[model samples]
Structures are given as C-alpha cells and as structure tokens.
Target chain A: MSPSPPQLSPKELSAYFAFTEVSSLLRHSVEKQLKDAGQLSYVQFQLLARLGDAPGGSQRMTDLADGVVYSRSGLTYQVQLLEQRGLVTRAPSPEDERSTIATITDDGRGVLATVFPGHIATVKDLLFDSLTADDIEGLERVLTQVSAHLRANPPRSAGSRKKS
Target chain B: MSPSPPQLSPKELSAYFAFTEVSSLLRHSVEKQLKDAGQLSYVQFQLLARLGDAPGGSQRMTDLADGVVYSRSGLTYQVQLLEQRGLVTRAPSPEDERSTIATITDDGRGVLATVFPGHIATVKDLLFDSLTADDIEGLERVLTQVSAHLRANPPRSAGSRKKS
Candidate 1:
C-alpha cells in the first residue's frame, strides 16, 4: 500500500496557496517587463545579473548553474544564446581546464542597465507596494530561513550533480 | 537618457533576492517529485488539482487559464495533453457553445491521489520545516496582500486578454 498523504492544517494549506499564487503573479509580471524592456528571459536576466555581480564580472559555468538553481546543460544553452547575442563570452578556466568561466560583456551590462528600471518598477508595483516594512522584514526572515534549508540539499549544486 | 532605475533599499533588495531564491528552489524540488512519482509536469499537476477542487470536477477552459496564471494557448495545449492521457475531457459548453469546459476524469483523480503524498511532503520538507508558526502567519499575510494587488491588474485575466 502507498504511504498516507501527510496532513496539512487549514492555515498551512492557505499559506502555501497564497505563497505560490503570489510568486507566479510576480514572476509573470517581471518576465513580461524583462522581455519588453530588453528581450531577455528571466533565466537569461538571472545569468547576466549574477555574472555582473561577480567580483571579477565572471564565474564558472558550473557555479552559475548552482547559483541560479538551473541545470548545467540548460545553463550552457542559455550561455550560448547570450554569447551569440554578444552579451557574454565563455572560456576554459585557467586554474582548471575542465571548468569553463563565463564573463558578461559590456553589452550585457548595458542590457542590465536598460532593463533594471522597468524590472525594479514591476517588482515594486506587484510585490513591494503591497508590503509594509514589517511585512518585508518578516518575508526576508522566513524566506532566508527557507532558502538556507533548501540550499543545504540543493538539487543542482555541484556536489549533488557529481553523484548523477 | 533612460530613466534612472528605481532605488531599492538594501533591506528591500535582500528581501526580494531571498523570496525569489526560495521560490525557485522549492519549485524545482516539487517539480522533480511530481515527475518522478507520476510522470506529470508541475503545470499538469496544477491543472488536475484545480479541476479536482472545482465544483463537479470541472471548470471552463478560460477560467482554468486565468486561475493558473497561464496563457490561453499554453493552457489549451496542456488540456489537450491531459485529454489524450484520458485524465480529462473537453466539451463544448451547452450554455455557451463558444466556450469549452474541461472535466477531470476518474483517472485524473487517481493520479492526484497517487502523487499528492510526495507533493505534500516535499512542500513540507522544503518550506514548512523552515518556518515557525509566526513565520507562516507572516508569510500568509504578506503574500495574500501581494496576491490581491497583483490580481487587481492581472496580465492574463479575461478582461486583459480581450484588449490584447
């Protein structure tokens, strides 16, 4: 016999529903903004944003996948697309030939600068506008705790992928 | 010159990052579980779940799209796939011949029964485990507020789509 489904309290169920609903709505709004403002997908925006924020404006492809919680092959495809668009370039890492590093180009930074205003506005209008300061604080605290727990057993982390 | 980007305070920035990261991670985990346990995509599972929850195990195709925050074309394709799987049936509504109504089949309910244990457990492990009761309360409150605001100007609501 199959295991019994776990019971969730009414409050827990409503919370989960609300959380997923808001995430879906907010993501949709931001994705539309990114597409309109810079013709970038959310994943592409995340890739460029992460690389742009890196200390040297670059990161290993594997690290990029881990940071964005994306699959390696999928990340490679996105990087290739970015490269074709002249927004980023990839090269073998000097310290480790097996690893590749991706660097955001000047064009990539330009795209970020282009889309950021609309992106920020969409986020602010859809999410932050409804939140009070206390709500924001609580959101940060709860999500940070949840993030740490999820990262501890990350599905796409280099260590996790090593086994597969 | 392009308008300057909206300024997000440091705390607000961190809160947004934490929210997106946790949602991504949680979604990834649940998607993996749904695939492993039932050969269902997250969207398919959502469709079935929504149908199951609706009165009489049915809903209008347009309403399904709006409720799921999915595009009309995309939702139609998913419904087709589910129909092919014998999990749902699409029929022209008697009251409105132009509109299609989707009804979940017994097989769809069976699939839900099969996959829900793992889905609930995944949600609990990846999300609820990280939260205190107070955190859950705060999460629900803040997210419910955000959802109401976003829904007010929803991008894919029937009224919005008519304009497009």
Candidate 2:
C-alpha cells in the first residue's frame, strides 16, 4: 500500500493464472455442452459417466467421490439430483449398506450417447484445438506429474471453505 | 432406466478424466490457499497482485479484466468489494471516463504482504513438491500453450457492453 508492493515475477504469475483461467473456461465450456445432452453439470455428467462404465455398472459413493474431484457430501447431493432426473439409481450396497452404490441407468447412457459427440467436439475445440499432437504429448506428460503431486498431497484439508 | 450399457474403453476414459480432475484440483488448491491471505479468491488475489505493479500503479478496468480470468462484470464486482475493504481506489480517467483506473492502496499492500508467503508455500507444496526442476519447466511449457489458446478465443463478443 505504501511504496506499492512488487508484482509477482511475470513468470510465476503467468503459470498461476494460467491454471485458473484454463480450468474455469474448460469447466464452463464442458458444462454448457453437457447441458445440451441433458440438464447435467460437469460433476453430474462425470459421476454418471463413470458409473456407466464400472464393471457392474455401479460403484460405492465413496469410491465415486474419490474417483473425481468432488467431495463425499457434494457428490451425494449431485447423485441425488441425477437420481431425481432418472439418469442414475442409488441404492445401498447389499454387502455393506452404510455406503450407497451408484449405478447408471439406461436413460443416463442414452443421454451420454446423445451428448458424446458434442462433448468430444467441445473438449477438442476448447482444449486440444490449441495443442499439437506433440503438445498433447507434452500436456499428458506434465499432467501426469501434476496429478501425482496433487494426489500425493491432496488439498481438501488445506483448501478454501470460503463461504464459512 | 433399464440395464447397463456398453461404455467407452477404460483407457480412453482414464485420459479424459485425468485431465479434468488434475486441472480442477490444482486450481482449487491454489485458490483455497489464497483464502488465508484474507478472503482473496484466487482471481481477486491475482487482480490485486497484478495491479500492484501496473504502469503508474493504475490500469483500465477493461484491461484489468482481460489481464485476469474473470468476466468484466466479475472484475468490476470484485474491485468494488476490494474498494469497500479499503484495498483499492478507482479514478475515472480524463482520457476515457468510460473506463475507470484502479490503484492499490497502502492498506491493500499490507493485506497482500501478510498473505502471500503462505500462498506461495501452498503452491509449492501442492504443485511443485514432488517435481524436479525439469518437471516444473515442462508444466510451464504446456500451460503457456494452453494459456495462449484461451486468450486468443475469449468467450465474450468484442462489442459487448463494458462491464463497468
């Protein structure tokens, strides 16, 4: 405030903001595209789409939460919303009823099938469009490192609960 | 809502979901860390931090909006909130009264100083902890391309109303 604080070196700040903007735009674009397939947020779409492919077409809710970026309760709420929409079914696991199992419904797969082309196109246009076949190779390489770093440290404990 | 349907190959889904999860988690980690820096959403922190070194300690609201990932209205709203907190001030430029120039205040710098160390530490922990210097360079490389792509195709129409 006084002498005017120095800016983050352009190099540091650029990477910081790059992750933010790229992800936000990607999320917005993907969500918009998914809506045309069904009234699904990206989270909802990911959840159903994941369950749609499990060996038995089902997974524990905890497994589902761990499988993606959403938290347990947040995912449960979305799964409830999806259940209401008839895209997925949630029922207690027979072996361990404390946790529910989520299964994708035929309707969910139908919607996913309906939306797949647009979803792929949107992802390609917004993300892959800007990358080369080599850039994709580079992205995959760096993303693996990043994904491992994040998984190893896992931020839910240390991250924001801003509304509070 | 009948039976299970055939699905995309697991390898394909793995690559697809990996990209989404890693990107979202990294951004969330960075933003969450900023909360401790005094309610700075990652975007807000980036805006204020960037403006700290803007030429003449001021920048056009539209330029500021483009500098960060936020929508023009989103930028305006957050700048107003920061102003209310006595962190920044806006002056209508004589050159373009339609565009306001925002300057950081001493009080704002104090807040940033207090918060930045921990934020950087978190970035290091969540992002760079496991990586070699080379990995960092690779991430920088890939993200630069992604950033360039996003900036080239910003979502809004150029002739849209000024957010401020």
Candidate 3:
C-alpha cells in the first residue's frame, strides 16, 4: 500500500483548499479582464509588468521565468510572442552573451497603462472588497513568510540549471 | 492617453503583490511534488480530488471544471487523458443526457492515495508550517469570503452558458 497520509488537521486542510481555490478564481477573473482589455494572457501581462518594473525596464530571461514562477521554455515562448507584437524586445545580455535579456517596449508600457485601471479595479472588486485592512495585513504577513520559505530554495529556473 | 492608475495605497499594492507572488510560488512547489510523486499535473490532481470527495465519487464534467476553475475544453482533455490511463471514466449523466459525468475509478483513488502523502506534506511545508492557528483561521475567513464572492457570480462553465 501507499505511504500513510500526512497528519494534517481539518483546519489545515480547509485553509489549504481555500488558498488554492481563491487564488485560482482570482487569477481567472483577472485573466478575463486582461484578455478583453488588452489581449494579454496572464503570463504575458506578468512578463510585461515585471519588465516595466525593473531597472531600465529589463531583466534576464531566466530571471523573468523565475520571477513569474513559470517554466523557462514557456517564458521564452511568451517573450518571443511579446517580441513579435513589438511589446518587448529580446537581446543578448551585456553581462553574459549566452544569457538573453528582455526589455519592455514603449508599446508594452502603453498596453500596461491601458489595462492597469481595469486590472486594479477587478482585483479590488473581487478581493479587496471582501477583505478588511487587518485581513490584508494578516494575509501579507503570513504569505510573505510562506513566500520567503518557498523562495529560499528557489525553483530550477532561478537557482539551478541557470546555464541550461 | 490611458486612464489613470487606480489609487491603491502602497500597503494595498504591497499586499496584492505579496498575495499573487506567494500563491504562484506555492503552486509551483506543489506541482513539482505532484508531478514527481504521481505524475499528475495540478489540474489532474484537483480533478481527482474533487471527484474522490464527491458523492459516489463522481460529478458532471461542467461542474468539475468550474469547481477547479479550469476551462471546459481543458478539463475535457484532462478527463480524456485520465480515462485513457484508466483512472477515470466518463458517462452520460442519468438525469441529464446532454451532460457528461466523470467518475473517479479505483485506480484514480489509488493514485490519489499514492500522491496524498507528498501532496499534503508539500502544502504543509510551504504553507501551514509558517502559519499560526490564528493565521490559519484568518486566512480561511478572508479567502472563504473572497471565494463566495467569486462563486456567487460563478464562472462561465458553472453559471452562464450552462446550456452551451
């Protein structure tokens, strides 16, 4: 037989389900808005937003993948699509020729500007509206701890196989 | 020019970013565990879990999709794969001939049993370990509220276009 199940209490189980389900719904809701408002898939929008927030509007390809918790190959394809749309540009990194760097284009910023209002509104409507400020604080505090723990042993895209 | 950005306070913005980033990382970590342990993708695991938890270990395909916040077509393909693997079977609903019902097979439960230990451990490691009882309650309370709000409107698969 399989190994015995982990000893999680009912409350722990409920919180886990709640976290995953709510996050999925929140993502789906914003994905529709992003698609309708600017034709951006969630990953594409994340790519653009990350680049837009970066210094000089740029980051290494692998870093982009890690930042978004996406697969390296998937990030490459999304960046290529963004490049084709003139929303971002890809080039060999100055610090490392073997590594590619992606930078947001004027059009990318323009698209983000176009979508930011609706994106924020949707998040607020679906999430913040249901949350008190204390809830938000508790959320940020707990998730920040969880996030730090997860990030400490970073994904392969970020920490290991960087040269791949 | 684009409309102005929403007036989200810095704290609100930080909380939002923290929420999205941490959720993504948590998902990535658990997906790896699911893949390695049972060769199940996150969606596949969720589908089986939902079916396993349902009465008679079955649910309509559309309801399954919405319960997991997956696209209808995507859920169909996943179900087909599961069917091929002999982990699940699909049949016409007795009450509604037009709707397909997916039932978890014994093998599906076996696979879930195999993956259950690792899945629970991964969630606990990445999430529950860092959270206190109060944190768990707060997380559940806030997320349950958000989940209800999102579910009230429901997704296309669950509410609107049900006849489609």
Tell me chain A's TM-score in each of the predictions.
0.91, 0.84, 0.89
> Which window of ten consecutive residues has the lowest lDDT sum in model 1 chain B?
B155-164
Give the per-residue lDDT of model 3 (tens digit) for A1-164.
44556677887877777778779888888888899789999999999999999999999998887678766888888988999999999889888899998999999999998888988987877777777888888777877777777777565443355384
The full ranking of all candidates by DockQ, starting with the best, is 1, 3, 2
Every model: iRMSD: 2.2, 5.5, 2.6
Q: Pick the candidate with the highest TM-score.
A: 1
- Please give the TM-score that candidate 3 achieves against the real structure: 0.87
The CA lDDT at B137 in model 1 is 82
Off by over 4 Å in 2: A1-14, A159-164, B1-16, B156-164
The local distance difference test score of model 1 is: 0.86
Best by lDDT: 1
- lDDT ranking, high to low: 1, 3, 2
Candidate 1 lDDT, A46-107, residue by residue in tens = 99999999988999998998788777889999999999999999999999999999999999
Name the regions of candidate 3 deviating beyond 4 angstroms: A1-4, A155-164, B1-5, B155-164
Q: Could you give the C-alpha RMSD of every candidate to the true structure, in order shown?
A: 2.5, 5.8, 3.4
- Chain B TM-score of every predicted model: 0.92, 0.79, 0.88
Candidate 2 structure quality by residue, lDDT tens digits, B78-130: 99999999999999998977879999888888888777777766666666666
